[model samples]
Target: MERNLMKGNEALAEAAIRAGCKCFFGYPITPQTELSAYMAKRMAKAGGVFLQAESEVAAINMVLGAASAGVRAMTSSSSPGISLKSEGISYIAASDLPCVIINVQRGGPGLGGIQPSQADYLQATKGLGHGDFQVLVYAPSSVQEMINLLTKAFDMADEFRMPAMILADGLLGQMMEPVEFPEAKTHQIPKPWATNGTGMKRKHNIINSLYLTPEELEKTVLDRYKRYEVLENEHTEAETYLTEDAEILVAAYGATARVAKSAVIKAREAGVKAGLIRPITLWPFPKKEIVKASENAKHILVTEMNMGQMVDDVKLAVECRVPVSFFGRTGGMVPKPSEILDKILELGGAE
Candidate 1:
């Protein structure tokens, strides 16, 4: 095992290289620009393909082109660039091509800010594209998860013949942390259930999600929903810190969770019985586990970097009588741990 103190962006690029990804296509975008730059410098030596496409649209199309050839491929961008890739993402999902799209999320709605934010949760899990298809969006809160999830993203894409996203934030992208690359197994790539080109084998198959007929489309949605249900059961993951006998439960993820962790510690120090629930997979959402906090707590505090995007999910999970409240700073402003602690204290005292 090798240990390296690398930034999350660098770790992602490195993990891609080690994951046997053969192509990387992306444009320069803040927070994630380092990932593209690193790929540009390393792809050739790694015997892979790396291109700085003219635009994110072009880049994701290039990803589509490579992935259709049955090779592992990827692209990275921030919020603005990801917007341009939306059409291409829809196409990839519709085609059921295997590929990875990394979004190191920033403040958004349009050109928001470069600071870290979890505001992309809705866009990633729900904003897959204009169609009824879904992308497997993985939210990595730490630099280590950035490395680990990249490999898992590639594997899942190939296994399910679907697109997977590593949804991160500026903090996870730019922060330097220790990560060890996992041992490689070349046969890890999924078999050709996905068409590289049928040639003489099994005839030509068009892997598309589009079905004009109502019945046909319903069947496709049903199949996709089944897969999503499997993901929910197998992939739902979360971390809890000190929820036993807690008066207030603070729920946060991505960079906000880092702040929430500190706040929880402080609240505990102050004897507030505050605790935290940090989600690792935002899509499967770990809602069941989070709701359990409400079973024992008087109130649940949802902190975020946007105007309460996650709070809605928290409320749904905790249900009405739990007194769910929201605290946030939009446009890239990250509230400090002390601020979060204060909010929790206020909520706890109210209870």
Candidate 2:
């Protein structure tokens, strides 16, 4: 296969177009703006529509509109921009619209910085919007993985009739790496519930999120939760390194996972039985793998580019069986491999 060096954000845009993305609606935000810019340059040639919406809120609603037509639509934004899109995201989820959302994360709280950070873990996994809903969230550690997972995100969003997200960060978005775009295969799934024209042969389908009656709303919510249960059982993914007989475990995702892998290597060279578990799916959250990895581990260190958002999920997964500690760098600061190695060694009683 031929490989090309490409920026992560641009690679993701090309991947989405190849994956059958028909429409893109997004506002420019640092780190993620490249993705939208690429789409603007390429989408029309691919027979797709690319519109830079007036704001993040408008962009997400545009995605919802496009998705209701039963077509692959997407939107991209950074941390604060994602916050602005949250309400529209919730509406899409409630309406059972399938769409892809790209979040190239940056420092947070309130427009913190343009540099990388994973502070949106809680927002993405726990409280994306003001509703009881979940979107499929994939965390990619490299440019190539970002391409692969974005394709999967489109497929899964269609399969489950809900939104899916690519949870990337500034580091991954801005960095360049060699990546291969495999021959594209058509994976567009059929949607029977779409509001597209019916050709007068079938009943007109309605796409809506509003239910005036309490009973109707309750029933709809319950049905959506059932689909979520099936999704949880079927599509959780994680990657483990050197955890077969390890005494210490480290949990991380996205760019932080790359650093954690290096730290694990250093610990191994020093004869400290340390291993790493990287979660590829942040929403369903690879809990089963975490439990298995924790079985023979003494302590688990959760590292991120933020102040310990994913640590809460790790603790829940472990069920308090092992000590779970957190080490992180916030405000656009990234944790160095040496820093993570020190934490691993300290957990291994080598420091």
Model 1 spans > 4 angstroms off: 184-187, 209-212
Query: Candidate 1 on 96-200: residue-level lDDT in tens?
Result: 788999998888878888887778778888877787778887877778888888888888878777889998888889899887877754346556655576778
Q: How close is candidate 2 to the true structure, as a TM-score?
A: 0.99
How displaced is residue 329 in candidate 2, in Å? 0.4
Tens digit of lDDT per residue, candidate 2, span 137-242?
Answer: 9999999999999999999999889999999999999999999987767488789988889999899899898998999999989999999898778889999999
The best candidate by TM-score is 2
Q: How far out, in Å, is residue 309 in model 2?
A: 0.5
